[model samples]
Target: MKTMILTTALLALTAGSVSAQQVVRLATEGAYPPFNFINDAGQVDGFEIALFNELCTRAEVSCEWVTTDWDGMIPNLQSGNFDAIVAGMSITDERREVIDFTQNYYPPAFSAYAAMDPDADIEGGVVAAQTNTIQAAHVAETGATLLEYATPDEAVGAVRNGEADAVFSDSDYLKPVVDESGGAFVWLGEPVQLGDGIGMGLRKSDTELKATFDTAIQSMKDDGSLNALLTEWFGGDDAPQF
Candidate 1:
């Protein structure tokens, strides 16, 4: 009886250890504001970080956050540098060809143009956009001269430095810049809606993990918790309904 009990205890401990090892490493750009950004303390803190924590808890999975450069986010994910990406990545057919995404957590959002000159011509003037983003691709397809930067801040800086006529990016990310510009930067043109929405990215082989996050996302949507977070971060009625 004593021997049997000892063997059962050992098996239980081993099982618990295996379960504990099943942690998912979540990656984020940590540069996009209101979504994921490095705070004053130099720690990753934002809506996506908070949302990802909640989703991991609901999915019953352990998660560790990893910050990566925006341009290399997808490549690093494919190289197994991380388990998943929770950055402000939009769900698009072009991206879908390279990686699978969970159901969108945020609804489709619009991109806007910002420049020092309120009357800057968005169609024909030089524009700056972060490399490897939807805005960059859109700028390339337009009549504007596209200048690509490695980071969003760099793209914005181009406009401030007079290197580019305007900077085009996600409205949510650029709105705060315009607000804080103190009459220096202003909106240049009508905002354009792009992509489907923002979702977590995972490898094609990570179907089970994707399903776990998808279920958690759906739960948040059904309970209105996701909307609450969206409002808390984004503010106003612009948050899309689930």
Candidate 2:
């Protein structure tokens, strides 16, 4: 009986340790360009991917990345398929009810773009964002219809094709797009009223895991590994501040 009791105790201890070292799975919308996008090589690349790699290494946790649709990322996260979310998800109050977020990894800025046409008479100075993002909401307070797009690329495409006056999206994405467009379009260069910083999302039930992630993030920030990786992916001047 004593031997059986000791075995049970050992098993309990082992299980406890395993629980502490649980595998961490991360999810992202592989469609957000310059953030987390599917590259021509059909592999995930960009700012969030590089950042997640550094974070996992510093946290001493093994990680796996799963591609998820933007609309489904939060729902899937709530289902327990992943331990954390590294997607470029804005840390908003609506999301805070369901998940806790770590320190933001990028700043929040919006840029408006429109096709180059002298007669277009785009009245809004520097352009305005869509109506959905926090920036858009700010634009709305000013009574401007922040142009909305189904996707970031759609917004870019609108400007490229001259469909909807103009479209607004994250500035990081706009930079690459503007370069790729080869001067066909013009960026209005208006910084929208939005907060900088992207957060790591964790299930509200996993407060301990959130704490672990924050510590890892702070360590990376202090040691410069995070900055090095950012410079490699986003260029030194454009890297988002942690």
Candidate 3:
């Protein structure tokens, strides 16, 4: 949820300040399905991708999509590799010290443990989580030993391979996995709510750009389009509305 890196697709540009004239280069992990991922067509496609396209349209700005490694994402942003990160990054005080965030695009998420064994001791068991996520942060303070992976798939794989007792992650990301697991994987314990929610990460100096996207986000919220998109991607059972 915190990072990713990939190639850039050329679109349009102007580039003096972050406005309609400039082709704003936006970054995403392109690995988290339903949120952001590389589709079979080998293009970035997901709920966030659709939302970004809409936000850019609303802000009247042209944008190009890019992907980058999760761990290096924030640093890459500061280095000007992209204009903003639309990846599913949680809004937290630690991140705020280095970058600013617009109002949340996704609501606070429930993090849960998934394991093949229903009786797995999540309290003191070996647990895997994507590095830099709020799920990983929660695990680090628990009786469970934390194993951080660079990607969400790897964290889930740890449980399948017996490298960890369970995988902890955003339930939205985990739900589809479990459903597709054919009775092999099951949710392990009570879902834990973590982070303030998902938001776009921007440089502090990009105040104008932040304002632009924020206005677009609120407009979607007010119009019910945001909720419709959320349900479409994540399902009505779990998708939270404004």
> How large an RMSD does model 1 have?
8.8
lDDT of each: 0.85, 0.63, 0.88
Number of backbone collisions per candidate: 0, 8, 9
Q: Point out where model 3 deviates above 4 Å.
A: 1-17
Top candidate when judged by lDDT against the true structure:
3
How high is each candidate's TM-score? 0.90, 0.78, 0.93
Q: Show the lowest summed lDDT stretch of 10 residues, model 3.
A: 8-17
Descending-lDDT candidate ranking: 3, 1, 2
Best first by TM-score, ranked:
3, 1, 2
lDDT of 1 by residue, 91-184 (tens): 9999999999999999998999999998898899999999989999999999999999988999999998999999999999998999998999
Instruction: Say which prediction, candidate 1 or candidate 2, comes out ahead on lDDT.
Output: 1
Per residue, candidate 2 scores C-alpha lDDT tens digits across 1-242 of 00100000011111221154566677776767777887787777788887777666666666667766555567778887666777677777867877789877665544454445533444443334433455455545553345655456765665566565555566666677667777766665355545546788888888777877788778878887777766776757867554
RMSD per model, one decimal: 8.8, 9.2, 2.8
